[model samples]
Target: MWRCPLGLLLLLSLAGHVALGAKQGRVRRELAPGLHLRGIRDAGGRYCQEQDLCCRGRADDCALPYLGAICYCDLFCNRTVSDCCPDFWDFCLGVPPPFPPIQGCMHGGRIYPVLGTYWDNCNRCWQAGNHSAFWGMTLDEGIRYRLGTIRPSSLVMNMHEIYTVLNPGEVLPTAFEASEKWPNLIHEPLDQGNCAGSWAFSTAAVASDRVSIHSLGHMTPVLSPQNLLSCDTHQQQGCRGGRLDGAWWFLRRRGVVSDHCYPFSGRERDEAGPAPPCMMHSRAMGRGKRQATARCPNSHVNNNDIYQVTPVYRLGSNDKEIMKELMENGPVQALMEVHEDFFLYKGGIYSHTPVSLGRPERYRRHGTHSVKITGWGEETLPDGRTLKYWTAANSWGPAWGERGHFRIVRGVNECDIESFVLGVWGRVGMEDMGYH
Candidate 1:
């Protein structure tokens, strides 16, 4: 073997250490020729693209300008998280220790500094004592998951006169709650878990309320959301998501049974469980077992219609029209838009107007959600500005904001809640109540 020079041996030894580090997945500058310690972000909120690794604290042109872009490194990134990569906490949660946690967000042209209205981090903007799942999604994603399209011929859409007549400055009642008026009929707020079953839950709850109201408390059965989650498939996708129109159409065409017969099991599995075989199928199987000679009906099992809603119609987008509809026809389902700031709401009248920086137009087209509009009232703010609000029963359980309820700005059709309000008449009969 040839003997190597001392200087060459030293170079080889250094190279070995670098190669070992590279194999261990650590960021090595010498081995990575094209790679350099480019400043993650320039003074402006953009990525740096200088050819030199150390530019003497000078920034280059920006390569990326998105809010949650990633910058790769190791120790430097961890030490200077805010300076190097503002969104590092979002993706690499354990990497950079949040010593001095980031304090605010610049959303939709508004600067919501931490400690003023809400807490801020890379993963979330506003922070409040609300449900965890509330912050898991953005407004756009939530809207896509919940709402179906609206039609011009819808009853709610047709009443442009009602909304036009109602003035925003008009004085209304100090407070109103549907639960207080009809404590026996109004159902408690339900928890839809992470599944997109708000369409089903709201539809079922509204139908149940309508049936109880029409029957004068004789039919107080908790109608099954599982029935809709499993059976109704026309323009609906079960837990993944479905349309309000499709849900109402299913209720009108194929009725549902009590929760005791088919319980809500959508949240039991990862995704909503597969559409189960209808209850009649199991009944037929049991009958066949008892009477060996009797042949089971060779029909599809989903036809066992126990309850139905007739002529599903939409309520007008006017605050008065919605209130009138609720008073006359129990609770109505309304489609509203959700936003990032809405998740942090604890109480008081929820108006999306930012006191500091953002514009209303920024969150105007965020996420869509459906809720049961139980009642409406007006609140006087500290500045003496009167805010009309609709009391809504949410599907996030009682532990959520305002005891499983929320108040949205009314009269102006805030969040489009008044845009696609749907109402229905549930069909009830003596035979339906165990008259068999």
Candidate 2:
């Protein structure tokens, strides 16, 4: 998603007004079947009514003309401005100039983008006052109309352009090997019953693995997600929803240990208790002794709290240098917006529809929390569709999908993601490694 040299405010202005007789050379190419270039005056005369030129009830009711003078019709004109602008279907059909690709999953002629397990269905697809599924545009028409011929550079591909060579055939180390020595490695079985803190569970598990590999020579004790979830210092909302930053803080203060002592209850505050002391030491002791060393701390750290949450900018933010550095250096967490028609999980490809950040409410509801981005994946859809995608480590438990993970397409006309806030956790020894 290229930033309009002009910002979103400027884009909104273009959508609201009729472009006067500009030079013919500046007009965008014809986008779809019903769309064509006409003089600004003619467009205004045809769309503008004596009262509200923008209005759609009557041909003369100009209050809100369909597609806002760019393309007007009785049925299309009646739709809201937002319904035609920044919408996946609208862009596919080229209703608005400079059309972009569509995101989310298409079902029954409408797009339904899923955020985690939640879904929002597009109402535009339904027929006038018809509740039945037969109402709206077919999937094919919507795709053709919104995702017209105008193709923009894929944000995912553009960001990873320098790493193309490495991307091919790249394989992420097993969860344990990725973060070897850390006691919190995800290898430990999760305690879903007592530790409903998905955020803490995932983060502690990943951090433990990473820290162990980087600091220790061996993959000793695997951290328990249940321990981090039930630990009092990191308590927030339950696993169904909780703060990502808070989860990391819990693990740093109270290093995860064996679940044998502290079991999971699938809910916060259930069977919770103080961590045991760390006592394992190598005295001609082998793997069993090392595993026993993962005992919990006698008492939780007093100041186990998230000092700050660093922002992880997505490809669209144009911070390639910074993003590249983080990906190469260590694990990076990010917040993203999910779209509908962009659903396809092939050999490994994950695609999403395109959506602009012009609307705040829509953007906020997309994805509120952050998750670690382990690596990237590429695959051809079962139907022979091809695309690149991101391999994200989500906060949801293993039962959610592929062990609590999902793939997001990288560069394709339709699968694009806007990333915000690359998240980082601050702990005693890692305070200096703050993200920008």
lDDT of 1 by residue, 367-405 (tens): 556789889887565556776778888877787778888
On residues 94-135, what C-alpha lDDT tens digit does candidate 2 reach at each position? 354333322322233322222211224421110101111112
Worst lDDT run of 10 residues, candidate 2, spans 124-133
**RMSD (CA, Å), each prediction:** 14.9, 17.6
> Which window of ten consecutive residues has the lowest lDDT sum in model 1?
1-10
What is candidate 1's TM-score against the reference?
Answer: 0.61
lDDT of 2 at 144: 26
Candidate 2 Cα outliers beyond 4 Å, as residue runs? 1-196, 232-235, 238-240, 258-261, 268-330, 337-348, 353-369, 379-386, 395-400, 411-436
Once model 2 is optimally superposed onto the true structure by TM-score, how far is the C-alpha of residue 269 displaced, in angstroms?
A: 14
Q: Model 1 scores what on Cα lDDT?
A: 0.55
Largest lDDT belongs to which candidate?
A: 1
Tell how far residue 33 is off in model 2, in angstroms: 44
Quote the positional error of residue 404 for candidate 1 in Å.
1.4
